[model samples]
Target: MSPNPPSSRALPPLVRIEGVTRRFGDTVALDGVDLDVRAGEFFALLGPSGCGKTTLLRVLAGFETPDSGTVSLDGRDLRGVPAHRRPVNLMFQSYALFPHMSVEKNVAYGLARERLPRAEIRERVAAVLATVGLTAQARRRPHQLSGGQRQRVALARAIVKRPRLLLLDEPLSALDKNVRAEMQLELKRLQLEAGITFLVVTHDQEEAMSLADRIAVLDRGRILQVDTPVELYRHPQGRFVAGFVGSNNIFSGHLLPSGGLDVPGVGVLPAPVGVGSAAGLVAVAVRPESIQVAAADAKGGEGLLHGTVLDVSFHGGSSRIAVTVPALESPVLVTASGPATVTAGTPVALSWDPSSAVLVETEETTWKTGGQAT
Candidate 1:
């Protein structure tokens, strides 16, 4: 799903989470977290497993109660709100559907429970099934449908109620790669068509980056960063975010007077002037795509670092080259465009623009309400 940027922090909030902390025995699932999701936006909680993303979603869904803090939805406090009463719906990764029920029945189950009129239930179910492209399979049982179809059925059921907020937990993780790709687009289309606020929880970075306009990155029960996909990619705040979001070549050492990293053995790496402290321990992170690599003998003033190409992988439009520099503990990865030009075992020189080198904190930082990085 492509990102649709929210209006601003000033926009009316649909979900307000403040200092919500939940504990299961001695384990702290959520660590004094504060988040605000704007109305009509597709937001994502992105993190690795056991990072409290799911726990936060459950709190908002009213399935789990927080030990401390409060959760408000559309200016209404949800302290005593039951899961069924709240204007919220959760779509699980398993896509739980009644095995004996037909597609239309599954979609109509919620409305039926509310004892709505038969005609109204039918009309709403049919409209939702059509929205998810499942009108043709409305009569099929759960087992008769494909994995993607069952997923669509679950989604249709959730949105048929026209809930104010729809929560999806690893929505497309079960499907095959091809089907997952198709469903991503389908899910976004459904969100726009239904005009429902979506809060998706996924550990897949690419999934969050592709689907959410704003992503809240969580780790160890804390939100490390929240920003647009491009901002998080190009301007990650610290080492954890830089390493987690994508491949980054990091050079760690003392900071020089001219804003360059003074490595003990790898030599100085470039950085923009006035980046950080004049002299102190620091690290410079450079993306693989930003690094320029060429045959060692291929001129251009002795490049920044010299290494031997350890491996080269062709990825259709791009090539991944791993170069082993003797001074660094890990190999430096370079994402060169097009097919491979340099082969393994060949000595190569790597150089990147000074401005591309970002000085990232060695420790994780917290993301607050003022749009500060972590």
Candidate 2:
């Protein structure tokens, strides 16, 4: 499957959150947050702890009420809806499966709660189990199943009722690295096949990038930016997002007369397009993989920044090289494919396409915090 959701902007949103605010005594959990989850869209709330992502998820599931603002599903205000009354299912981080019950029984538990017919429950349970590739494990208890299997069972249980929306909190946190990778693909497939709007809350950036069609980056109970993963990574609007979403070689400088950024130690580097004259400090984030490293003695004058190789580590198909330059406070990280021929203390030259860099303003005035500003 493609790594993005299909364009469906003309369609109405399935979930809408506007001016939502929730607080915990002295602390604000959500600050005037606004968002839209399109129908059949895989959306993610991504941020660090205490960012109010989980709190917002709870609000959607009817487990928590906003102190102010409104939340609606399909244009219907969900003001007084209780957790059990909402047409949404929340799959917790723990999976929360019944230890003694078999997978099939666990999957059918939700259906039974609605007092559905036994044959229909069996049919739905079996169908979902097959969809999740867990038909063979249908009779296995929670303890007898693997971490990934148990997760699938939890998912099956949540989806068996065929809720209009699915809320997953750290859904793959319990699985191992290999299994987690596998489940990422499975989750995406299931979301598409079931045609359910999924709103997942995760602290893992890669998880959000890989799974969501659009991601809302949250901080301190505020939604900072909501965009597709590629857009968030390639074109972050501010310093926090540039540093948060991915590794970047950041340099704080001021705009030069020629529209370039005069980095203190690295000299003037080409500024990204659309970065008009901003009076204050401007920070540029250059992706590690976008940089080209060559021997210092190489015949390149323009667009070249010299540095000393501090370290290099091989990571399967790619190698991460740390280079210490004169002006930058931190060593710039460059990801070069294959093995690195450079050694520690070796002089190196780095060059990148001018367009590869992204301009981000660091002025406090533009900084978004406390969910008060978007």
Best by lDDT: 1
Candidate 1 achieves a global lDDT of: 0.86
Candidate 2, residues 111-209: lDDT per residue as tens digits?
A: 898899999999999999999999999998999988988999999999989999999999999899999999999999999999898999999898999
Worst 10 residues of 2 by lDDT: 365-374
lDDT per residue (tens digit) for residues 41-158 in model 1: 8899999999999999999999999999999999999999999999999999899899999999999999999999999999999899889998999999999989999999999999
TM-score of each: 0.94, 0.93
Candidate 1 worst ten-residue window by lDDT: 365-374
Q: Write out the backbone clash pairs for model 2.
A: 265-327
Model 1 residue 107 CA deviation (Å) reads 0.4
Against the hidden true structure, what lDDT does model 2 obtain?
Answer: 0.85
